[model samples]
Structures are given as C-alpha cells and as structure tokens.
Target: MVSAREEILNKLKKAIHPEPEMPDFDAPVYHAIDKSLGQAFKENLEAVNGSVYLCKSEEELVEKLKTVLQNVPEKEVVCSENELQELLTKNGIEHQDYQERQQAIEAGITSCEFLIAHTGSVMGSSALQGARQMLVYPPQHIVIAKKDQLVDYLHTAYDKIQEKYPDQLPSQITLITGPSRTADIEKTLVMGAHGPRELHVFLY
Candidate 1:
C-alpha cells in the first residue's frame, strides 16, 4: 500500500523541470507604468486606509501638520528627532519627548529611510537612530518624508539602502504598508490590534 504523501512526492519528483537562468543584475524586478512615483505611492497607500499629504514646501508642511494635530494635545504627541523637534517648536507646535510617557503617547512623528511607491510602503530601520517601538507603539503613526525619498519598487529601495550603508545593514528593517489590522476572530476586522490604527504620511 502506497502512502498518499509518498505518492505525491514521487509524482512531483518525476515532473521536475530544468532550472531557469538567472536574471541580470540590472534587469528590472518590476515594471511600473509612466506615472509620478509620488502619485502612485499616494494612491496605493490611500487604498489601504492610510492618509497622505503632499506639501509644496516646508511652510506648507508645517501648516498641514498643524491641522492634523489640531485636536490632539501637544503632550500626547511624541517627537524625538532634534531637527523635527526644532521645526515643531519653531512653528509653536509643542510636542512631548519620545523618551517620556511611553504609554501616554497618542501620536508619533518619525522620519523614514525610503518610501516604496509600488507597494506604498515606508522603509524604516533601527539605523535611523531609535527603537523600532517608536513606529509601532503609538496609536497613530505620522511619517514626514521628502519627495526624493520615494522609489519605484521594493528591489530598488533595497538597492538604495545597500548603497547608503555599504559597511553594514541595520539589524532591523521594517516595511509598513498601512495601519495595523487583523481579521482573526470570527472574521471580524479590527484595527490597531497589533500596532497603530492610523497611518499618515506627509511628503514634501
């Protein structure tokens, strides 16, 4: 008597084909249509319930950020980067220190390494100078990025990261496509189950 597992393995072994040739290093892993990378990134991210704000300048970026944080108190918003903190302070938008009151943080504003346009993902790494928790623990995650940071695909993003850090890569690299969500219990969808419930990206 032949076991079902053994029979399936034998059939698969007999049907194996020759290994295909490897692609060239410069070969494109993905083909993107002729369109703005920022637009594509915005559209894809918005499709997953994430919000994007396109700012023409730093002043406009600050203005838009103010509107987003209008309802939330300054004490609840956490910002760590010195440059961002200075910008917030200069604009009269006070924020709490990221090191303090971890549990009370309602929103977190952080910089990202790169933004992948195709998947609408933000590439973050510990090399940026903070714990990965800064991205996940907050109920609302706010990312501030530049237009130059946008890339066409994940492969290109990886290549850029490698070029940027030729010595060694960060121990942790995270690609956040959208806010955290789960549909495990009885197929009932829930947001913020494992991480932030809301994701907002401001690009200039």
Candidate 2:
C-alpha cells in the first residue's frame, strides 16, 4: 500500500511537471519569508498600535522594551523570569510571571511563535509553557518569529517539524490566522466575539 501511494504521488508529480526536475523549494521559502515578514510587520503595526523591534540579544530586547514602555503610563509587563523582573523593576513597571498572569490576560492580548504561515496561521508548541494563554485570551496577539522559522506554507512547516523531531510531534497543534471573529448576529461582522480581535506577527 505504501508503494502504491508513492507511485501515485510520483506519477502526479511527473504529470504536473513534465520535465521531472526537482523543485527549487528553497527559493519559494525565501520569498515567502520575505513577503510574509513584511506583511506581518505592517499588520502588526496597525493592530497593536505599537511598533516591533528586532533585537539581537536579551540586553537589546530589554532596552527596546524599556524604550517602548517609557511613555505608556500604568503599563504592566508580563514575563516569565527574574531577568525580565529586573528590567521591569528598573523601569518602574509592575511585572508578573507569564503563568501567574494568565488569568489577568484572559481578556488581554498574548504573544507566541508561528509554527506555520501557509494560511497566515500562528502555531504554538507546548514547550513554550504558559505563553500559549498570552496568545489566545487577549483581544490582540503579537508573535515574534525568527527568519528561519518562516516556511513557504503549512506543509513545509510540518516537514521541518518532522525533521526536527522524527518521532515526537506535540499532541496538539494550532493553526490560527487573523483574529477570532464571527458574523452570527444579524450577519453583522464582529471582532473578538470568541477570542482576540487582532493577530499580529513580528518576524525578526
């Protein structure tokens, strides 16, 4: 049966490309990364009413966050470590653990990583721990993805995952695009009906 499936797939591939040459998967991946990152930046800027900063190190990240939060009054910073605690304390912003703050952010925005982007979906792994709640419960979400994580599409992301963990894929995989929206009430479009009203991505 496996052989038959392979044969069928091979035939389909050949039929689609008569030359039967290997596709330049890397090119598409690169282009997708560039395009998606640009789009994500624009969308995020608009959605978050904030700017995305690409930092090379933790120190730079802290500095950027401090600068951004300088003008925002009464902004509580939610994070997971003592490192961030130090930064927040120095900046005079209240800090809360990412896990402990989940309830508070249930109506706020969360941020996470994008496992795939084919359909503009955001993927989160359990290993990220309590960060998942940050991405789900808020009215707005922001994600910071490294350049290498970008793929041409969802299947490519899946392929990369399989390659990295041949036998240990996570039990749950989420593909989210845009905001959690609906139009059930008198067919009127509504945002944040079920979840966040906006989804933003910062590709760095």
In terms of TM-score, the best-performing candidate is 1
Q: How does each model score on lDDT?
A: 0.89, 0.56
Per-residue lDDT of model 2, residues 1-204, tens digit only: 569889999899888845678887767453345555445544434453333555565456556555544543333445543543564577565546666653444232233434343355666655455555665665555455566765556677777767766778766656666677778889997877787775545555
* Per-prediction TM-score: 0.84, 0.56
Model 1 C-alpha lDDT per residue in residues 1-204, reported as the tens digit of each score: 999999999999999988988979898667754689988999989999899998899999999999999888778998887877888899898897777754488889999999999988999998764548878988999999999899998988999999999999999999999999999999998999999999999999
Q: Which parts of model 1 are misplaced by more than 4 Å?
A: 1-29
Please list the residue runs of candidate 2 whose C-alpha ends up more than 4 Å from where it truly belongs after superposition. 1-76, 81-94, 106-117
**What CA root-mean-square deviation does each model show from the true structure?**
5.7, 11.3
Locate the minimum summed-lDDT window of 10 residues in model 1: 94-103
